[model samples]
Target chain A: MGFIDARELPDGHTVETDVCIVGAGAAGLALASALSSGTGGARVLLVESGGFEHDDHTQYLHQGQVVGREYPLGISRLRYFGGTTNHWGGNVRPLDAIDMEPRPWVPHSGWPITRAELDPYYERALAFLGLPDDAFELEAWTDGKACRPWELEAELAETEIFPAVAPELRQLGAVRRASIEESANVDVLLHANVLEFETDDPPRAVRAVRVATLQDERFRVQARLFVLATGGIENARLLLLSSSVASAGLGNDHDLVGRYFADHLVIPPVGDLWLSDPELPLDLYLERARANATGRAMGRAIFRLPDGVQREQRLQNCGVQLGPTMPLDVAIRRGKAFRSLDYAWRAVQEGDLPDDFHYHVANVIADVDELVAGGYRLASYRAAYPTWHVDLIAVAEPAPNPESRVRLGDERDPLGQRRIVLDWRLSPSDQDSVRRSTDLLAAAFALAGIGRVRVQMPEGGLDWFRPSPHMHHLGTTRMADDPKSGVVDRNCRVHGIENLWIAGSSVFPTYGHVNPTFTILALAFRLGDHLRGVLA
Target chain B: MTTPFAVRRRDVLRLLAALGGAGFGAGAGVGAGAQAEAASRETLVAARVRLRLVSPESASLLGAAYLRDRPDEDSPAHLAVALGLDAGATDIAAIAARHRDDLRSGRVHRLDGFGFSRTELRLCALLYLTDRA
Candidate 1:
């Protein structure tokens, strides 16, 4: 394998390979690694827009407008060799089986493939992610210690385990970069930004991709097969940009290329829980260090609504986790004495205090005893053991809406490419899912005699509940069996293009509550195997 | 002379009533000494009736304290006692009336330097009121 900087290549250079994969993120890197080792022995070319480290010029290319709500477009994604994996939190869990099935309530829901079909690939993906096999099965990973007590039996809620690899070993490029660089069948090209796709007459098959460098160098990459592994937003942007033959875009004959965009809506702590027995071991609910045959792994348990409950209630899939919560008034009053003094001094210097200044002062005075007690507890816990209390936090699936999409904008980047316009919208059903799920969870908790849950609803109802996006971009170029409904086919191939395929979460028809990286790897591995069989 | 056991039980009841009154207002005590005397017999009857409302576990815990046995400090009854209430007071109705004004105003004063959180103190005040109501 040889590493090449496309900027250094001569002008009008052309490279030919058996398979060319665009975007060296988790999906692209995984596919390249898989193809290089298989018995088919096909040559692979992985193209990345940015260098090894982040470059400001390349990152600025992701800047765009957000028509609905304030989405941090420029800062949400990083354009580099490793892609956004460099900064990901490494929370990995497979989507539930029901997420793939069509629901009457969820519009444009259902995956062309079922969970049973993807099970083998998910098992293989565990190895790629460095997680223990069958880690997502709570009983197997926790050695049967993850069970809830009989006294707290609630049919609506069940624990789901998330198995995450250590932070240092999770980066795809950093962990597998050496093997990829050493492989004889792979060639990695940095700074090779694919500008447009050149296709045959009628644009049924992509012939080659025109590449451009920041220094104005031009080249072409001809391949037997092409996979666009760019993220959710960029995948649609690239397809929309290639409009030579199909004016609507290569696979946009039905005008579905950039439609049906979705992302996981993460709602912060909406309720508080006070357990009757504070001494119960909640280690499963909290992040714990576990020793397995391989090495140390991190595990955290979350409560998911049972499939039966979701079907009966007609609600979207959601998961709830326990997190520590303190009343805002108490937290402010319980600061260190010196910090309180400093705050009081600052307020005095400002000439006038804000509203409820006297009330806050009274609270601080009232909390002096608690402050001293908390100091002792902190010192004692540091010397010996510790305790934890938590509130309920939830993540819910967003119903797919064609109105939420990404389109090519008028403004062009430094490379003369039009930037993207992200119009992220949430449908009424999406808001209903969060509200209904939270209410059910609260009822279940009260029924179990665990405690009461105080749901925090916005003053203006569910419509006013503004949740910050979790950056898990999904479903721009969604996959389906029919061309009129989706951009990609069942095998992730662009509906009309023969040799071109789409990878990553962009092909996901529904955005499950779980994080997308693990599933992305599974799909990539499955695609890699498919390509190997085809090329052989 | 009353035995120490009987005296201790009476003392605990008086303290509970005084703590409850303190949460209402101290002004409720002024010029109410005659009224408290009038209500003393009724207050005792009220305390007996309210004792039925407390959970059996809480009642047992309070009984253990009255018997001079070391009850669990985390027990609800002991928690109420630890939150600035004198456990050795006499005359339940008089002390309750004396602290009514401050109690009604929700004024909390740190009589003892014991480290109790506001939540715990509030819970203690609530327990006392529930018992005396």
Candidate 2:
């Protein structure tokens, strides 16, 4: 494997490779790794806009780094070789079998491939990322015969709330750095930006890619196959911004280059808890949430909420937050109130929320004072990083709102590429979903006889509604069977274009609450395999 | 049986103390005085009431202090708080945006006229004067 830094290359030269892959993020790196050994001696070029994080400007957010002060949540996404894997929460979950199915109730729903089709890739993905086994079915980690969580306290929550995890704090660059060095077929290029694409006459097969450095040096890399793995927002922006021949852009037959843009409207919640070990210790929930937190089967487990549970009975997602804290008095009955960040996290989008959606923390009054003072305060946690103490984000699905989308802003990046103006198109349908979901969860809370919900939606008064980023942006260049329906075909190749392909969460038509890292990796592997087959 | 809604100040303090850990007992004082101060502040409190906004324009002046908790950001709420709009009129979107920062710091504020949803009691902003009625 060879690494090329885009900052170098003072003289413009044309290099030939079997495949020229653009953008060295998770999708590109994963695809490179998948093909590294599979396609023997096949030349694969992996281009990154920035250098490694040690000297990387992105690590410090140098372009527009505003540490401490929360400037308008300009993307926390990294642009270097590894991309966002630098700060991923590492909770790898397979998209549920149902997620791939098109529910009559769910709008614009479908996954061209099923969960079963991606299972093998899921296994290999976990292996490549150096992640622990699913740990979901091991008996020591679970009940004796049935396989369960490893700890005793986890059983309570597990019996009631099942959670899944990917638990590896993986840095994709490190994974690629270690793996690519041993590969004979891949070339990982740092700081190599894909400036433009050159196609052959008539058929329009991509013949070569124009690579450039910020230093004004230029070069070319020719390949049989080309992949635009430049992330969700950038991929679409580049195509729309790249108006050399096509007026509507590269894959704009349906005008879907940057249209159906989406991210989860993160509705964080603050709820009260006074868990006692009368039959089980508060330590059980605490230890689970503290240690495992959905990855190790201890905290924030994943489980299916019985359908028809909510009044609307809509098929939806469920992940809970209630952990170990010192015993205290729950004033739910007294109509007592302690403003927890939890309250505002849920109803953040009902109002005219920001595109990078968020909410305010009123106050978090614990049923027990000790939980607030120490046991529950973010600064007190030892198992997890203390800095993650603030509002617990209870991510909610921002149902497909065709209106909430990304458009080309009047601004441009350094490359003269159009600046993306994101308008988080939301509607009453989203709020309706939240209200109904809240009602359903409250009913469940009532049934469990735990604590009643004291929800205070934004409509209550003159409370400011600040929206936060869900970090799960998807669906600008969706894949569908028809050219008119989506920009790409099932394999993620641009419908009209011969050699252009896309990678990332962008291809997803519908956004799910579960993190997309695991699924994203699987898709990348599939794409890599397709590329190899083409070369063969 | 449902747990009785009995709130003990020590229980509150103990909760904070546990979170503070062996290092900072100062965080342990779940100060009842502080709670009482918050409860009785001159701010028009809407304990579990709907907090709606009429528009994005008024989000800063009335509901700025009560929007999202920034604690350290240079957002409108931080600006409004600095400008003395702790408990004034605000919009639902403004409150929600401000709340984005509040989640990180657990800050609170109150404005006039606010309302909450009928089903789950979530906040919804119509106008500040509506907070009382």
Interface RMSD of each: 14.6, 15.3
TM-score of chain A of 1: 0.88
Q: What is the TM-score of chain B alone in each candidate?
A: 0.26, 0.19
- Alpha-carbon RMSD of each model: 14.7, 16.6
Task: Write the residue-wise lDDT of candidate 2 on A374-416 in tens digits.
Answer: 4344344333321111112244555555555555666545655
Top-scoring candidate (TM-score): 1
Candidate 1 has an fnat equal to 0.00
Lowest summed lDDT over 10 consecutive residues: which window, candidate 2 chain A? Answer: A384-393
Candidate 2 chain B minimal-lDDT segment of 10 residues = B115-124
| lDDT (tens digit, per residue) of candidate 1 on B1-133 | 2212223433443454344311111122222332343234333222222221223223222333222322235344444444334343355554443343232222322211111123223333334334443
Tens-place lDDT digits, model 1, residues A175-214? 8788887899998999988998889879999999999998
Q: Per-residue CA lDDT of candidate 2, range B1-133, in tens?
A: 1001122223222322232211111222223433344343222222111112122112212232343322343233343343223354323344433333332122323233221111111121212112322
Question: Which predicted model would earn the best lDDT?
Answer: 1
DockQ of every candidate structure: 0.02, 0.02
For all candidates, the clash counts are: 14, 120
